[model samples]
Target chain A: MTKEELKIKIEDILPAATFDETGEWLNILIEAKAWYGFAKQIRSSRELEFDYLFCLTCIDWKTHLTMVYHFTSTYRRHTIVIKSKLDRNNPEIESVAAIWRTAEFHEREVYELFGVKFLNHPDMRKLLLTDDWSGGFPLRKDFEDPINMIRL
Target chain B: MIEEVGTTTEGDLIINIGPQHPSTHGVLHLVITLNGETIKNVEPHLGYIHRSIEKMCESLTYRQFIYVTSRMDYLSAHINNHGCALCVEKGLQIEVPPRAQVIRVLMDELTRLASHQLWWGAMGMDVGALTPFFHAFREREMINEIMEETCGARLTMNYMVPGGVMFDLHPNFQHRVKKFIEFFKSKIDEYHELLTGNMIFVNRMKGVGFLSKEDAISYGCTGPTARGSGVICDIRKLYPYEVYSQISFEEVIETGGDCLSRYLVRMEEMRQSLSIIEQLIDNIPEGDFQAKTKAVLKLPKGEFYSRVETARGEFGVYIISEGGTTPYRIKFRSPGFSNLSALNHMAKRSKIGDLIAIMGTLDLVIPDIDR
Candidate 1:
């Protein structure tokens, strides 16, 4: 489907959705509270079976955190991006691990680096960091590693 | 301190496979729960080599960060840099010249061939045959010499920049690549004779660590690993970057999801890579290699992502730029991380020796996973 058709289809499902088509793929911005249902529709809708969760990450914007997901359909051969903004103080979102298994690892990585908790995630522990680490989320803009003196 | 498996009896054994095991190909720690040579679970402990590359890239400029990715998957360093360069170019809206695109495709295919050669050798060695390692490197050295002569680095050649390549091809780039392709074509037959038809190697690999098509997709497997299970996840075909759209090559697929299927998929992939290189090497157009760009690049405030089919799988570069010379946030979707995530699923109920066969076909490079 064309990007314009995708925008219309998504608008029908969630009228509050906004799109940014400046980049190559179509980016849909949705509310954090509505993400779980919206993601399920995106996967189950016959026209848009985004079966592959190719990339999942978090962007720390100081005031808030944005969770980004890139998906592609092997059958339809179309790609789309989904973004949801979360409160920076304590970010939490529903986990899609049950829907797409790839989200299990990607969510764990984001959990350790950005401190975004994935609700309902089976095994929620540090996947790439030592268990004893007590520093704040390193990917956050305000994170300061006094021991390493690493700040951006 | 270990968590017991479900309904465990008195004699269940849990073993540590190596944060420094030689067969792992890198520093990958696998905690295996064994019930007398049958694996119940295989959990991978990463971060031993986690350099926090995403955190580090926030501090480097657009041009400087490309080299950091070279260390992620050192085996497919060229493809890793290419993905980052493509993302930067996409953000800045720079159109690379046609000549540079062709050269990039050529280099990428050569890199794939080199990576497969190493995997083929190491896979044999992992299965207890040592001679294939020497034979595999003998062919790989030719490709490395060709890369060194042109890109000026052996493994981590930071040859790609935002707009185009770092430098134009060397004077003998075409000659050397052609020679290497011809030499490799002849050696491929020898490779098949030495390992592919060997009864012991076939017996060890076939029907070991079977991952069905549905499972491969659910686990996010890509490249030959996914293709071995009859899933068409080849990024070159799915989302063509560079001149790949114009090239004609088959996405090698096998119905058998065993280690042998994965092994044959990679073996056929090497042949396909040779064909791709042969098609592009002769027709490299003569034009400006690098497009002219500003002294400093500042991407508009937006998100840009690009993916390349690396030797192991699909490697993606996602950049969030806030109209600055440096990215506000950068995330590398390395294939090893997702591929490694499926090790537990693949290794379950397999013997201790079969784990080596499974990992060998997976062809993991742990730095990529940790990064």
Candidate 2:
């Protein structure tokens, strides 16, 4: 499907969805409150069935956090990038693990490094970090570790 | 504390396998819950070698960061570096020369062949066949020699630069690759006779570690892992980059959706990689190896993502540039990471001995997962 047709179809399902066309794929920016609802709709929607969640990650912008979810339908073969803005101080977003099983690992990695809490995630503990780790979110912009991390 | 570690309310046995186990091949830990011989749950404990490459990339410039990627999936090092370079090229809007494009593709295929060869040997070893390991390495050594001659490194050949390759190919590159292909082709049948047709191997692999098509897609498994389940998730065919669109190679798939099917996918993939190398080994275009660019590279403010079919699966490089020398944020979507996620789902209700075969087929590289 062409990007134009996808935009038109996505518009019907998500009226409040803001589109960013500057990048490669059709980028959609939605609020954190609307992420799970929109994700569920797209997964079940007849035309825009975003069944495959290929990549899921969080970008810490220091002041706020942005969750990037790259989705594509295995059958339709078109790709889209969906983003949700979260307040960095208390970053929380609905977990899509139940919908896309791959999100279980990706979300857990994001949870530990960025300190973003995943709501209703089946397994919500540290993934790549050790149990004794107390270092503040290593991927955050303001993360400081004088001894371990080499600062440039 | 020791007693509490193993026994649950229902009297299930908990077995801890390697941060150093031979079967694991790298630093991967799994705490498996077992009831008699069947596995109830498999919980993976990672982070033993987590260097946080993403955070490290935030500090390095566009040129410096691409080299560090080879350390992640060292098996598919060239492909990982190529993916990173592709992302930077996308952001910079640089057109790689036709010759460089062909060279890059050839290197990618060779690397894929080498990676699969190593995986083949290791998979055999994991499944308790030791002789196949030596035979597999014999073919892989030729590719390593070619890599060392042309790229100056065998494993982590950081040969890819943003615009194109760091330098032109070696004088004997084509001749050596052709020689390796001919040598590998003759030994192909022998490999089948040795391992693929063995009666013990067949019984151990067939109908074990079953992964359904639905579950495979949901877990985001890619490369042979997903193609084994008949999902048609080959990034080379789905989203062709470089000279891949021009090449005529099959996206090998097997419908078994078991350990045997996954094994067949990689075995066939090695042949496809050879056909690709054969097609382009002599057809390399005559032109500049790299495009003209400034020494100090800078990317405009935007987001760029590039995907390449690595030996394990889809290796993606996502770069968020803030109009600076360094990338604001970078994320590598390693194929092994996603493929490893589906391990527990496939291994449930399977015997403990079958776990090795399942992991062998999955081809989990711990560094790629923990990176």
Candidate 3:
């Protein structure tokens, strides 16, 4: 399906979602609360069985955190990107671990690096960072490390 | 969706198999919870050698970032660098010259073949066969020699730049690659004799690691790990970049979804890589190897993603540029990371020895996973 078709299909499922059409893939901006429902729908829906969650990441805009998800159907090969904005001070979003198992790992990586709380995530722990890591979220724009002595 | 098992309970025996164990390979720490001899849960405690390449890439220029990726999946360094280059080129909206495209593809296939050869040798060593390791390295040494001549370094050559490969092919690159392919082609049959048809080796791998087609997809397994279950997850075939669409090769798939099937798929893929090298070795177009671009590359404000089939699986480079010289945020979706996520599922209910066999087939590289 073309990006137009994917946009229409996704619009039907997510009413509040807005899309940015400039990128290569169809990009949808949705609310953080709506992510779980949309995730379940896309994974199981007949027209959009986005069974593969290839890349899940969180971007720090300093003021707000934007969660990004890149999904591609195994059979159809059509890809889509979903973005949800979360308040950087209290960044929290529903985990899609139950929907796509691969999100479990990516979510953990993001949780530690970006300091985003993945609510209902199975194993929400520091993945690439150590448990005793005292430095704040390394990926955050405001994060500082006395060890590296680098300040942004 | 919580961890199925990994928590220690009463009367459970657990063992730590390396942050440095030789069998686990390359600083991978696996915490195995056991019930007598049978495995209960295999929990991987990572971050041992994590250098945070993604965090570092945010500070480096687009050209400087590609070299750092070589350290992530060192075995498939060329392909990983190729993926990053393609992403940056996509952002810049420039086409690589035909000569450079062919050279990049040739280097990619050579790297894959060399990487698979090392995996074959190391995998054999992991599973109690020592002689095949030496046999596999004997041919890999030839590929390294070619890479050393052309790229000027062995592993992690840092050969690929943004627009194209940093340098043109060496004077004897074709002759040496052709000779190596001809020599390796004859030894393919001997590989079967030494390991493929050996019953002891066959029995050790045949049905031990059973990952179902659904589980393979759910776990986001790619390359031979997914193709072993009859999934066509080859990025070269699915989303061909460069001159792959022009190339003729079959993406090898095996339906068994066992350790043997995954092993067989790589063995078959090595032959396919050779065929690809054979096809392109003679037909490298005569043109400017590098496309003209500014010395300082600043990707336009947009999100660009490019995925290339590395030796292990799909290595994707996701870049979000804010119209700056450095990427705002860069993520390297190394294949071993997702493949490692599925280890617990595959290792459960199996013996401790089978863990090695399963891991051997998965071909986990520590830096790739940790990155």
Q: What DockQ does each listed candidate score? A: 0.66, 0.71, 0.57
lDDT of 3 by residue, A66-104 (tens): 999999998888999999999999999999988888889
Over the true interface, candidate 1 deviates by an RMSD, in Å, of: 1.9
Model 3: docking quality category: medium
Candidate 3 stretches with Cα past 4 Å from truth are: A149-152, B1-9
| Chain A TM-score of candidate 1 vs. true chain A | 0.94
Any runs in candidate 2 off by more than 4 Å, and if so which?
B1-3
| Reference contacts reproduced by model 2 | 0.75
Top candidate on DockQ is 2
lDDT of 3 by residue, B46-141 (tens): 899888788888889988999889999999999999999999999998889999999999999999999999889888888889999999999999
Q: Give the CA lDDT, 0 to 100, for residue B167 in model 1.
A: 92
Give the candidates in order of DockQ, highest first. 2, 1, 3
Candidate 2 per-residue C-alpha lDDT over B137-161 given as tens digits, one digit per residue, 9 for 90 to 100: 9888889999999999998899999
Residue pairs clashing in model 1 are none
Best by TM-score: 2
Best by lDDT: 2
Cα lDDT for residue B73, model 3? 94
Q: Candidate 1: where is the Cα deviation over 4 Å?
A: A149-152, B1-10
Higher-ranked by DockQ: 1 or 3? 1
